[model samples]
Target: MTSTAASRPGAEHNGFTGRYLLLLVALIWPAQLLSVTGLLAGNAQSQIAVHFHTTQIAWFVLVSSLIGAFLTPFVMRAADLFGKRRVMIVLTVLGVIGDLVSALAPNFAVLLLGRGVAGFYAPIAALVFAIARDVFPPRLVGPASGLIGGGVGLVALFGPFLSGWLLDGHGWRSAMWFLAAASAASLVLLMTVVPESPVRQERTPMDWAGGLLLGGGVSAIVYGVGRGSDWGWSSAGFLASVIGGAVAIIAFVVVEGRVAHPLYELSMLSRRRVWSVFLATALLAGTVLSAGTISQLLGLMPKIPAVSDGLGFSATKLAWIGAPASVVIILTAVATGWLARRVDSRYLLATAALFAAVGYGLTAHFHHTVPQLMTVGIVSAIGLGMIVALVPVMVIEVVSPAEQARANGLQNMLQGTLLTVVTQLFFVMMARDGRVVQGTQFYLDAGFTNAFRLAAGFAVAGLLAVALVPKLKRLEEAETGEAAR
Candidate 1:
């Protein structure tokens, strides 16, 4: 579901100005899926890694990142070549099926496969932005992107708490089942509400060699980092995965540069603004994502059983723990959208990053008590909401109208990939004995201050990333000015 741009004459002149809002409703679910990755990360520390006999939590991060990196750009290009609606529907269906497979998996291998398969569908982060770019005027794009992101943040607020509760009570599998339902519903919504893009482009052939090479490269890097602690960094398996992954990426670069219609347009990478948005998006996602992971970890190993286990509440009840955060995100998202319309998006982005850093820095210190935790969560949610909402809007600002869909998709893919990779690295370093271990004692003894400090550092980096964006804008404006003269 997406807003088609008012490209055709009289489309905006008629009663169609607000029509994109209708498509945006359908777009919400895919963006909702982004929360699933966070949920999985938090829950995996409790449920999956040990069951799979993995010593390191990095594997989960690695697999998710590899899959996302491989699939996102490919899906984006596909959307451009075919049609967004067509590709979106296919992704939805595949995601639904992937969820079912993940929920019903009998073994770690199957579970991993199912989770990885879900990544292939690529979430709606990019797609929603593309839709906004398609449907709205250039001026309205920034606000529209924020509006859609706000909707997505609403989902994020609830998804993790629900996932945490389900993991605590029934098991992680139940969480997967929940996602499957959402995916199916999204599919149905798309079918009913999404309209085909009136401005379709000629189809390009699937770049099989490029896709495989890129996928293999990412998988190898993810695998190496994920299993490094368990397999030994110097071991053949680790070395091969890392070095081989790098080679694969190099191969992809060469192939893409040679191709007439590359899977990823190399020229796009040369654009300074695009890179700025990419780096900022990755950092912002990683920072806010830490919130969900911390929440799940806290639930898994509370100071007492009653608190950790939700006081014997049902999974449904526990899910509501995240509802407040979700509600705030929705409100803030709308607020941000309104604000974006008034101010430059760069300012909005920087403010969000600063607030997020402060919120995470504060939240990390108050993890000893649940009420304190809730307060932190609320503050962080507001900050996180502000940051995440800008992802697609940045894309719309940097890319041309025709390139919006693919560029947005690739943006999400890269961000998700980076987040996954970083999550794996963090887990590997943070976990005890390279296993899905909880750090309750560490938090109690050393205090939660350390984690908060680390999170704040990440947030600071994100702020810097946001600052870089404005520089790109200034550069573009200067180039335009010189051209005008």
Candidate 2:
């Protein structure tokens, strides 16, 4: 729609028909499709690994997610400064172009770069939420946000099966083609049907200084971590990257403190309640991401007792068998949403942490059969679902209304940051522990052993962080954070 036909401040009062409602639903499908499953290449990991002739398969997820984690705040802030429609359209174009780059790449470098570009999908959901608030009435905004936020349930339910068909039947490139095609369709609908949001916030200059510091710091650190297995851990190159990145982060915090419109509001970190959310988010979110990758890796093992005993399934069978857990997770998320309203969120977090700990810890020792692994997955899925649902709840209950958006943005930033660390950490362990057999890299039984043990440890640490969380002051009347609003 053109600006002349665009929505205005009071246009939300203008009632919509089923036509507009369908448009909103259309907008949500791609947002969920790309943002949640974009970097999740586990379904195609074995093929991509063998095709690229490298076990640094972690980079497939790490680099894309690192790019997303480091840059999402700036992108979301850009949406707020410029316009949502223009920014969302730009991100969609970037995704399509990125997919094309990834699909046709001749080497890993080009594909990695393409995946990084595709990270633009991460901030699209936040923009979707803002657009809904601008376009819908108050009565409908809640349902719209709920639909967009938790709608991942339905996606999760079918995502594995769909990936199994596409990746197994056509090849890994088919998956990229699917995302690109879906994103392209979403882009056309978004441009033709979704009008620009007229709602405005306090207009401020973009915080390029803070963005550069944070981005540069994160790039250096992740570069160091991702390469640590290749570069000796104590090597000067690794030391320089880690030390330099830490210094840059310190500089970012100082710069943010002085800047009028900080990219990441540093003062919020001073609050105990808020920092606890961040700390827990960092640890628990990492474990959550690691779980999917761990399961995929487990599925590919050869199932030799005492040497390597795992499901020994192809990616297709892995996806089909894992479908049961996805169903449980979706159901648990629904139940969690209901429970969050009635229970103390910290109790939820602590309970989730324990469940995750037990599930991962037990799987470290006993992963023999499909039934055994399925039980472990179902147990962990419950905890993972609760943590996924409650992290936002904890953010709202802990942060004051004034700083809620920044808190949420920073929370997302922290989640991505820790996820990168955990993924790199696991791969590093695998590299260190695995063996080369007949020119093929094999992750030994010991590697999976240590990785699951480490995951359990991280969950326990998250539980400690949960203990420190206290109910924060809230303006129940004020708007909650944008992810759910």
Candidate 1 segments exceeding 4 Å error: 1-21, 44-62, 136-140, 160-171, 233-236, 302-324, 433-451, 471-485
lDDT of each: 0.64, 0.70
Listed in order, each prediction's TM-score against the native is 0.82, 0.87
Against the true structure, whose lDDT is highest? 2
Question: Model 2 off-target regions past 4 Å?
Answer: 1-31, 34-40, 126-149, 192-199, 301-310, 398-405, 437-440, 473-485
> By TM-score, who's the top model here?
2
Per-residue accuracy of model 2 over 433-481 as CA lDDT, tens digit each: 6765433455766787788888888889889988888764432333532
**Candidate 1 residue pairs in backbone clash:** 4-134, 4-135, 5-134, 5-135, 55-434
Shift in Å, residue 453, candidate 2: 1.7
lDDT of 2 at 328: 77
